[model samples]
Target: MKLRLGAGGTLRYGAGGTTDLDLPGDLTGQVVTVDLRHVDPGSDAGATALLSELIARGAARLVISGTDTASARALLASAQHDAPPSGLAA
Candidate 1:
């Protein structure tokens, strides 16, 4: 499946653990928000893992512009925990 992470971030995920994040894609400056707070328990782990990887690779950043505070908090929390490397800079 393909998912667009607002503001130029994009990701592709498929079976067998194959995935890609960022990859020079464009978000078209559309400020869409994702409700991460209520992500089902089953998918939370995967979301966290994917966000961690995106941060690690400098492919994503935290931005707030939605009505869902809980979701923003969850995403921010994940970013903080992972803490992408400064030098990696994508």
Candidate 2:
């Protein structure tokens, strides 16, 4: 996984491709930018799992990246109101 320090304390994770990240509580409130459209299906589950784990361990927010920044922002805005993409009660 790649990591970069971003402006305003954001932690940019990926830009050109997709990757599974293991974020910790220490990074809470930090932005997690990634190219979701290119995320491999196999890695998607793992990435979601990692995010879920982070939430359980006390993470608060994530910032996803896409071809369009506006779309990414809209997606994240909606994401904020929804549950993490995995491990919800059925």
Report the number of the highest-TM-score candidate.
Answer: 1
lDDT of 1 at 52: 56
> How well does model 2 score by local distance difference test?
0.43
lDDT for each residue of candidate 1 in 1-90, tens digit (9 for 90 to 100): 233332223334333323564433333222323333334444444555555554554544434433266755786687658755545534
> What are the Cα lDDT values of the candidates?
0.45, 0.43
Off by over 4 Å in 2: 1-20, 40-63, 83-90
Candidate 2: RMSD to truth: 9.1
TM-score for each prediction?
A: 0.41, 0.37
Clashing pairs in 1: none
Q: How many residue pairs clash in each candidate?
A: 0, 0
Alpha carbon deviation, residue 30, candidate 1 (Å): 13
Model 1: lDDT equals 0.45
